[model samples]
Target: MTAALWPLQQAVYAKLTGHAPLIALVSGVYDEVPEDAAHPYVTLGSITEDVDDAHNQRGLEASVVLHVWSKYRGFKEAATILAALDTALDRQPLPVAGFKDVSVAHQQHTEVRDPDPDIRHINVSYRVWLTKS
Candidate 1:
């Protein structure tokens, strides 16, 4: 399950960010989101198991992170990225039984870092839930 979920999260990141390098740079950003997002960054950042019970009896929990940059910082870019992510996930081909329930509990811009005082790094996090189909 961890192996499968990791790839799914990567796909989500690709769909939202549209670039590979940017995603790799700020993987830690995903940890900042409120717990409500349900592993939102799963699509973008590396996944570390927070809690897992045998046979997924208690389900799985993971953390995700993503970083982005732009001349402008606002919701337009965030919204667009999120929308694209949703579309991408919807179009994905699930396993034979498929996913029963998938939910994103939170979405927020957790941080803005300026290295040169001119360039900004935008970090976003979200929580996601996946159930059997």
Candidate 2:
């Protein structure tokens, strides 16, 4: 059985960046958080995988976080970004190497007003189910 964490994350990156509308609205999508990045962009956050095996099959429940950052005046920009992200990933088939029939579901999301008073953050979490091929 192969672990699908990195493969799934890569697939998520592909999905997020490939969406034309999302790319247009945001500055960029990234796995690495760059220094001095432009506002209203998305970045890959944490990926935590756990065991979820079944009869004669191996599976994993992956918890992934996608963070939306904005320096806009309010939460609307971040909320819009979150919507695009949900449209891109929620209930979508994410292709992961060494895995078959990967499924993704939107778990939950949170919006945070940064103490800096100049930034807004939205964190979205998704649960991915991957079965070993």
Candidate 3:
């Protein structure tokens, strides 16, 4: 179960970064956002995984969260980015190493106004199910 997590993350990162439309909207996608990272960027958030074996096969269900940050003065920019993110990820094929029957789906998302007032945040969650290779 643990083994599949990293590969899944790598696959997700690759998908996001490799997507031209999404890359054009943000500075970058990151697992760890740098201190001086620019606005309108994406950062990988929390992930929760659980064992879900069946029929003698090892399976796992993972919840992945991604955050979109923008200081564009409104939610429009952030919302656009979120749409691109959904386009890049929702129901899309993710090629995770050492895993098969991989599937990804958009679970939900929330738009938020940061306390800073100048910032807009959107939390996007995706559900992934995979069987060990």
lDDT of 3 by residue, 100-128 (tens): 99999999999998999889999999999
Query: Better model by lDDT, 2 or 3?
Result: 3
True lDDT of residue 45, candidate 1: 49
lDDT of 2 at 119: 95
State the lDDT of candidate 1 residue by residue for 1-133, as single tens digits. Answer: 4333655455454444554433443232242455554211322445443444447544344444555443344435444444444443333432312344444534455545466554444455555445543
Off by over 4 Å in 1: 1-5, 14-43, 52-58, 73-99
Provide the overall lDDT of each model, using Cα atoms, as 2-decimal numbers: 0.44, 0.89, 0.92
- Clashes by residue pair, model 2: none
| Between candidates 1 and 3, the lDDT winner | 3
lDDT of 3: 0.92
Across 94-128, the per-residue lDDT of candidate 2 in tens digits comes to 88888886898999999998998999999899999
